[model samples]
Target: MEHIRNFCIIAHIDHGKSTLADRLLDMTNAISEREKMDQVLDNMDLERERGITIKSHAVQMYYKFEGKEYTLNLIDTPGHVDFSYEVSRAIAACEGALLIVDASQGIQAQTISNLYLALEHDLEIIPVLNKIDLPSANPEEVSDQIIDLIGCKREDIIPASGKTGQGVDKILEAIVKRIPAPKGDPNAPLQALIFDSVYNPYRGIEAYFKVVNGTIRKGQRVKFMATDKVYNADEIGILQLKQYPKDEISAGDVGYIVSGIKDAREVKVGDTITSADNPADAPIEGFEEVKPMVFAGVYPVEIDQYEELRSSLEKLRLNDASLTFEPESSAALGFGFRCGFLGMLHMEIVQERLDREFNMDVITTVPNVSYIAYMKKDPTVPVKVNNPADFPDPVKLDRIEEPYIKAQIISKSEYVGSIMKLCIDKRGILKNQVYLTSDRVELTFEMPLAEIVFDFYDRLKSISRGYASFDYYPIGYRESDLVKVDILINGDPVDALSALVHRSNAYDIGRKMCEKLKELIPRQQFVIAIQAAIGSKIIARETISALRKDVTAKCYGGDITRKRKLLEKQKEGKKRMKQIGSVEIPQKAFLAVLKLND
Candidate 1:
């Protein structure tokens, strides 16, 4: 157990976590020269294309230090705030973390947030200054920041460049010397915490876990404590670039168990796996349930694919445990699942995955944060409302409370004015601000979760010229004057497009939604009326003229009365069509509401 060092890499998005991971793998000789690649741990094409890690990946490495063979279990985690749950789980399974900070960008929001997470888990933090090779890199300044943030000594911070492989050997030496090894009793009953899982179509679900106590052997009957379901371990193995089957994996080791469990729902992340015969007294604790901040409806483009969508979501959830969904139906979109996502980026990635991985074309409705609606009759009972369609009648509602978040933004001092303006426009209150350096500032704000769900991040990035890093966490609910805004097409309310928004911005947002929908929705045979309403009051309206076929061209040479008759006939036909014509809202229209500011 002393020879086993389990740790993860934590950082802000694009702070060279994956690049540093590659160098570590190369130095440890975990992967052959032929297998060397950029972001080798990020296997998803979407991840590589976006230049970000979306999922946490784990691999085992063998490093020889001073003639002693040491086993290193390295878990690479995503740096985005939307995938913080991935970082949390990775931290839970390890004893230490490499806090990577970009020397040029210094300490950003996610960098601080992830460090706090690692600290909360009592993991040893190794501050590493990455991207030292950049021309603009300021290692001395960043080192000072790291020292102030984590209270580490100056020499303890390692200045490393993940690109040129500089200081990688020193990093390995630090991992061996600084990070504590896994501690557990091999004689105790089997208690393995499943940190992550993946679905294998040919084999079954492969659960990746860390053995905290006792041994997990091949062919052992294991029971998942959370599900209380037992299954024979078809194969037990260590995770390298590939799975290497082992007869047994003892305590303080990281490995995988393939039990031929075809049902994806049967396996749950953070569940404890124990020996069925001699089970542990209790399951491992400290893994909190993932709380999704953003909620939206994911409906199949084709209604008949509902069951297929459900199965796809089930399988996808095996890979991404943070995603939560339940069956829901909408009058506008038919049957669908209301999915809870960590944020806008997570929601977009899931939508992209469903299309590319499952070949499932899905329509995602407007994303919003969940609200607590109190009824006038039952004031004591708080009704949780995630979907706008589930919102109780305003007449019977006493008040609505919206989720608020403590938003931390680190940016250049030059953009402070613009960033503050953007946040304030979103109904945010400035809670605090501090200057980390003469030119760098950290601003904290209390903002409604729903305000930032749409284009806040995009605008912030633009305003800061990509110099800002933002992170946030829910700060519970606060009473607010919020109203349900409904988008009506031809005077019919579309439940999928309804949203609970603050009353202050309701009229402006409604006007923008109407104007955007007018451009996106195609012209029908009759005039299409798009109205944004709050109950019976129409706050905004836009009209798309009918696609005329030039009916009067055939009678151009006729008398004025004859032309009038032809025009009258056409107008009558349009009126009849408008009465029976149901608007077919394009998918872009539903997504346009999310980009109203754009």
Candidate 2:
């Protein structure tokens, strides 16, 4: 334990967290020169395509410092705000963190977020200025920013570029000299914190854990403290950047516990693993389960794949605890699952995975936040409404409360005025602002999560010309002037198209949704009318003219008497069809309204 060093790489998205991990692995010779690829820690194709980290990965490295060898355990974490939970779990398992900041980008919103999390975990922060190879890189300036923000001295900061593999060896040496070795008792009752887990076809389930105390050995009986399900450790292996067989995982070391538990639901990410015969008195405070804040209804584009979509979601949910779903029915959309997600990006990821990985084509409704509805008769009985179909009548509602977030944005100083305007337009209350440097600024606001759930990110990017990056955390529910805005298609309410909107922006948003829907929805045989309404009051409406059939084509021979009567009959029949006929809204319409990309 004295020679073991457990630390993680923490940074903002696209800030070289995964690249640095690869460099560290290469420097330690954990992998052969031929075995490396860019962003080796992010194995998913989706992650590579987006150039972002989606999951947390752990690896073991061996390095020599001052004639003494050290076993370095490095956990690479996601840098996006959506995966902040993963960052926290990674930090919890580590004694120190290599805080990587882009020398070109300087400090970002998620950079500050991870820094605060590392501080809260009491991890020794080793400031690293990455991407020094770029022409725009300013290591000295970033080091000064790190000193100002984290209170670390400029001299203590290490400058390196993961791209060019510069100063990586120095980083490894610093990890050994600065980061404290794990402290735990080898003879104590067994207690391990499961930081991550994955399902395997042959291996059943693999529970990745850091042994807090005692030993986890093969053939030993163990159980998860959270689930209380007993399993014999069929195999033990060290994560030497790859699975290497091991006889036992002693305290303060990181390894995986493999049993015949193939079911992913049996093992959870934050569960404690301990000896069944001599379990610890208490479980360690390891990881927190992420709660989803955004909710949407996902239905199959082809109705026959409903069962396949259901099974796929079930399988996905086994590994993703943050994803939640329940059976939901729509009059226009048929049957589907009402899914909950951590954020919009998370929602998009699940959808993309379902399509790319699971061979499923699913259509998702507009994303929304759960609203707390109070009964007028009894204010004590508050109900959480995720779907608009279950939203109570206006007569029975007292006041609705919606989720709010403490939002932060780091952007160029030139775009500060527009960013503030954009935040104010989204019902954001400016809380604070700090000019980080002459060229950069950090703006803080308390905004409704619902306000930013739709097109706020896209608009923010557009308004700032992609110079601004935003991060946010939930700040609980706040009472507000919110109303359920329902879309009525040809005089019928479509529950799936309903949304809870703030009164201030209700009219404009309703107008925009109607217009977008008009563009996406096809022209039916009869005229289609789209109306956005609050209760019975319609604030916005748009019309799509009917696709007229050339009834006069066949009447070219006679037009004086016979054609006039035939045309009159055709017009009457069309009027009746318009009264009773329903519009078949395509899948694209639902997706288009949810997306407000300009």
- Which candidate has the top score in TM-score? 1
Give the alpha carbon lDDT tens digit for every residue of 1-598 in model 1: 9899999999999999999999999998899989888999999999999999999999999999999999999999999999999999999999999999999989999999999999999999999999999999999999999999999899999989999999999999999999998989999999999999999999989999999999999999999998999999999999999999999999999999999999998999999999999999999994689999999999999999999999999999999999999999998889999999999999999999999999999999999888998999989999999888888888999999999999999999999999999999888999999999999999999999988999899899999999999999989999999888999998889898888888988999899999999999989999888999998899999999999998877774657999888889989999999999888888998889877777
- Runs of candidate 2 with Cα error greater than 4 angstroms are 557-559, 575-581
Candidate 2 lDDT over residue span 1-598, tens digit each: 9999999998988889888888888888888878778888888899999999888888899998888889999999988777787788889899999999999989899898889889888899899999999999987888889999988777789999899999898798789889998889999999999887776768777878999999988899998888889999999999976799898889999998789886656877778899999999999987566778889999998888898898788767655657888998898888999998988888988999898878998888988889899988999888998877778898878988888999999999999999999899888999999889999999999999988888788888898897798999888998988778899998998887888888887898799889999998888888889999999999999999988877777766754788778779888998999988878877777776666545
Candidate 2: deviation at residue 333, Å?
2.7
Q: Candidate 2: global Cα-lDDT?
A: 0.87
Provide the overall lDDT of each model, using Cα atoms, as 2-decimal numbers: 0.93, 0.87
Q: List the residue pairs that clash in candidate 1.
A: none
Residue range with the least summed lDDT across 10 consecutive positions in model 1: 550-559
Report how far residue 442 has shifted in candidate 2, in Å.
Answer: 1.6
